[model samples]
Target: MANPTNFPDLQVPGGRMHDDQELCEHLLRSLDRPALLEILPSKIDLGGTGLFAKEVIPEGTEVFRSIPLLNCIGHEMSEFMCDYCHTSLTNGIDAAGHLRIAGDALPTISRCTQCGVCSYCSKDCQRKAWRKYHKLECPVLGQHPHASAEARALYRLIAMVKQDSLSEQEWRALAYLKAHEEQWSGHLEDLMYYQPQVDNPHRSTPLAFAVAARSAVRGAETLMQPGIDNLQLYGLYFRILTNDMDVAGPLHPNIGRTVDLVGSLMNHSCDPNTFAFFEGRQLRVRSLKPIQAGEEITVSYVDAREGFMMRHDVLWFKYFIDCKCNRCEEEELRISTLMSQESSSFEDFYQAEKELIDIRNEVSRDYKAFRSEDGINQVKTAISTVVSQIFRTQPWPDTLLPMCHMKQILAELSFKLNTNPNQIAIYTLQSCFGITQRSGPHWVYALHSLATHLTPMTAALNRLKNTPPLLLLLALIMRLLAPPAPPATPPDCPATPRQFWDFYNGLLYELVLQSRKTYGTDSACAVALVEKYARARARSSWLGPEERPLPGERGFAERFGEAQVAMLG
Candidate 1:
């Protein structure tokens, strides 16, 4: 059998190299490699069995860091009050020391010493708002009393502008308002009631309020902030409130809020390649395996069990786009009724529900067995079985299985593996593909299964490329199969052993090709890997003209040749 190519050696301090097959062995030897502090110029390479980083990332190398763009103090309350102090308001307020009525009666108001919008009872609170941005916005409060919720939210934002980093537009808007105090003094009766009968019936209340606020700032071009395109800013702001209000519930008081834009961009994939988590105000994105550059970053928004139709509905609602990704395609193929049938009776859906419940029960039993006996292998086998059963009974078998139950299983496995890090490999597969860290281990295991098994199935699916379902499955399989490679190898470490190189390259090649077929070469993952492969081939002294193939040219025969040879030998 041809020896596998050498895996690249990473430059991280205290790091060592091992063969690809010895990944289990190396993992057993060392648990945690080192903490990543910063993103390196070169991406990390994961094709090899062993993990490696290019430079010696210190113990606290910040792998990811981001400050909150928008922060809310008390967002969780059923109703939003003043943006500054967060006090509940009885009714909206007007400039003439009079309160505005919500329905018929006047609503309560909080008064700010520096600015009326601050709405704080105490002088100290007034002082804080003044320092933030209220000094600029105080004079203009009377201009737009019935602004939209989003517009009012924008006003609170202006009042909080303590930083000098205000864009030119924002400063001008502020300055313009200060100059034209007389223009905003009168109680414009037209402003008392909203314009009746608009196109968007649902938007009347909020839109009316927003239009009033915009009217107040209309002439004050100077006050507009730079890069503060009102529409986009307003859109982002609204998106944040819609998604995060529940999570930032009133009980947990926070000064900052985070929105996962990247996570949001990742339209749903039945077999997703990435997972996300929130740390304080920051969103952390991690690859379950080596994620290739340029692939569309994705997250599994729905539970793995949801059949194709159910998953599609939820995804369409949240993302507002039709999902044509790989997993969706597979579900279409495996379950003929998945896309066409709408459940008319609860009993009609009951059979599918029963299958899921049975699978869940069996998984739980397997988890208990693994826990009681400390049998890692047994646990792995049981997990594999449970996963297979779940897949077979899935509402959309073509897509990846639902993640909820799998997440549960993976969590238990993680707990068991806490004492044995070598078991990390088993978990690592799932971690790379199954569930976000928030979902835990069962999802991770399922991810592993998808990445390992389903990804390869794309080749078979390609024959049916014209079919929408097959095309979608191909796209998903590509993402799960091929992820980004880790950063370059360090100079001091030995070159990646042949055995390791062959294993990693073969797996990566297969994944890359399938991904190309499904997601197209333009996909973020495919493009990233193609670039890396080009660079690697360029740098390699061993590749002669005959040995090298053009990008995406290495067929399965060449890529997986060593693996097959080894098995036969």
Candidate 2:
């Protein structure tokens, strides 16, 4: 559906307007509609504040999906190019005939074996090269002395072009280069001039080169489509390839498109709602929280914990903009010594909160002893104590502790369970479940806490089903504790999962009526028990078939039997 102009306006919780309509319109147009809507706030208040819904949405809802406005595949798809051969080091191949993987040693240019325009280590490399576009351009290279460089330059050119739909001028440029191989050399020169150059005596063609470069640059500028960013960084790398011919790179197939869309929209925030996951080719956006309709959707440009100065520096380099988010505003407020002193009093008190510290230390020690002995009982005791403390503390649970302290406790427990998935892990998990159940049937943390414990417990259960009874007990506990299906409504909004649970239970009650039509009331009771146990805890007060209906009570089977038969028929 097309984006509606009348969608609710979103503002900060306390009636803050981050941007006006003109800015919002510009931002929305810049983003793909689906991506924009994924982060948009649900409703806007007249005061221009955005408040998120308070319900928890299911985990795998399709938030936003989109095809890139521009798509590009790297040249490696066309040829077997070595590090020394490819212009983009980020997408370079190595001597082993493999795409150079990132975060590894840089491949040496000297190892490159020239097969034609492209270089490889051996025949296997040549074959790999041929599978790529190399075969298409290989023959033409032999026709021109500068074919290798020309092909490399053209590959880089085509790679960048893939990110956007080519305009008529770009289309004509591509066709012309394809028709006349020498034209690639002229285009390469134009790209080089677009980047800043340092003085070098060995550089070819002094005055004529300068004149040709200036003319080509001006000509290229005229041909370029409007609205495209200058992309000076990519241009700089292009210039480097022209100067230093030996640089090799990684096989970043998605670099072109990633830079085109996500890279273009990159913004910084110390706290961000949008997170990106790269799934091979496409970049996916997940909402960490419910975003309001008109709010500017933002992603963390760097790790969140970095101090303001460091984070700001990184964002400036990437997005070329200064961040002025709430966190930064907090940092600015902290700079005043008077304000800092006042804030520090509460911060110190919170930091030194004795009850939190004692529980944390106890949990930590219990974890260590359990790990050393591989003792399930010890782990169980520790987990139980932690969960007890979590609930006793009211709203702020143990899971919401300060990062360092929370990580420490989680790490210790995680280590014991991860290293040894025995009875101890089950007990530790059951303790979490016990706390969740005790907390309340409808507690929000109940499902999340159970899921955290069960994820590992499930794997262990699969491996140790035939082991001890205690282990099996733990597994069953974990299974029973599995998080309820994600809440039907968004988390920050007013709706609660309990409402949805009631609706779902109503559906199950109806299903029981259908079962009675096929099997009779006695069988219907059994089905009800089974379904109820699967979805929720069994209650002692639940009626059985032998029991007569009370004054105002209706048996589920008797009340809905006719409807069930009609549905079946």
Candidate 3:
């Protein structure tokens, strides 16, 4: 365990330094974020902390950009990514479920020769990683090559502490996070005695914790300044699980998990004002909506697009938090109102609620058991079952949340199968609708982008079934996907078999405009969108008609109205 007596500057958690607003400022200063944000006691979480905006923060303003304090790539993805810089080794798999060949222009990833366990994109990154913490870790990882990503992350954190690689401020920030040791220990005991199957795979049992901790200690203990016991290690593990964020990027959505000082301090909300996005391994949080001065800066820990019940249950089970956010309160009232209006009797409502929950469980079980090698028919059957069981229930509107949850799984399965673009579009569209109806269009734009890909000018445009709805959806998606400002100079257009320059111009142009609003005109997202717009413009200049949408597709309002009618059916 860390000894505060050795370092007089470091105060224990729950001490005056942690509770005092003045001393906390010094800790927040270490983050070097915008002065517009401050750490404050949260009204939302009783006796918990939160981040607040010190000044009015406009939409699209960059709140902060953080390089991870600690991060690790998942074991399954270690082969594909550089363990040092977290860069992709290959172009990754294409839409057809085949691995895409990396072009000669890209840098090649190389494995470390000593241990052959970690990979690096360049020699510089390799040396830097070794100097940072990998000098001690490589041997351990080499011996236990099959260690889980979480265990590896914890091991790396411990190695950093032993080597004094982290600054005093960084160490203090991490130690300040709550471990929930008592609550988690009780939960583990309950799981051991009562449950045969683990509800969450990431959760640790007493036996598993002992084995992981012993293995880590055996390899790294020799190097420690102040050694830690199993109890202290278990406490750290609980803290890691509670505060970690999924490290996702544009290229790879599920790369790994990371924990950082500033990012973890932000609390969860069902309807958050800010959203985090990534550029390589660096995380940048931007305001989704304008935030007023003194307002709490919150982000959704779970996907806000998810139905209320799913969000509520996950929060309660994992964080031990019963969310009483405004959104949850409204949703609760809405559900009650809906039940009273739609239900013929209390008994009917109970039966419908029971049926909905049962269907969710059944889908969840089968979905987990499903493997890529399995037939697509099983997934299709699950989708059908969810729809038939819940979509026509007595209070079907109340069941939309679970219905959407099931559709989310179906959309993911469709993407994995990579067999039918049409199915992908349909499932993605349904999934997006479920989100847009509740959270708003911004949350569902990524899903909509998947569907929009099917309607590219080069695709078989005439073969599309719901042309108006599809076209409208594509237009809306492109509009949302675009950044604010376009490039000053158009990029050269690449040759295609058949060029629909007009469609390309409209789609890419919308993407550029939307990007400017969502991300700043100078942001990486906006810059990338501008480059794409340039190519479309270069092509449209000579090869096609004036910038126009597909034939007979109306403006957004009309299209949205038509789409709503079509979607409800």
Provide the TM-score for each candidate, comma-separated: 0.30, 0.32, 0.72
TM-score of candidate 2 on Cα atoms, chains taken together: 0.32
lDDT by candidate, in order shown: 0.37, 0.35, 0.58
- List candidate 3 segments past 4 Å from native: 1-23, 89-104, 111-118, 143-148, 188-226, 251-253, 332-374, 391-422, 437-448, 455-507, 537-569
lDDT assessment of candidate 3? 0.58
**Candidate 2 minimal-lDDT segment of 10 residues:** 244-253
Better candidate by TM-score, 2 or 3: 3
* Between candidates 1 and 2, the TM-score winner: 2
lDDT by residue (443-523, candidate 1, tens digit) is 322432333333223333334333322222222222233444223222232222232234444445545554343323433
lDDT of the structure predicted as candidate 1: 0.37
After TM-score superposition, the amount by which residue 198's alpha carbon in candidate 1 deviates from its true location, in angstroms, is: 9.8
Please say which candidate is ahead in lDDT: 2 or 3: 3
Instruction: Report the alpha-carbon TM-score of model 3 versus the true structure.
Output: 0.72
Candidate 2, residues 1-569, lDDT tens digits: the string is 02211211111223122233333343335443343342123232122223122333222222333323222223332233332223223333232333343375763322223333344434554464455434433433344324223233443333334333233332321221111113324544554564444243212223233333343333323332212233332232233222211111111212222222222232335665554433222344445445554455455645443344545654443223467777677754543332244344433433333344555556644555545444534544544554343234332333232223333344446544565443434434433433311211112122323333334433343455333323233323323234342222222333122222222233334333332322223322224333442433122123222233321246633533322222222
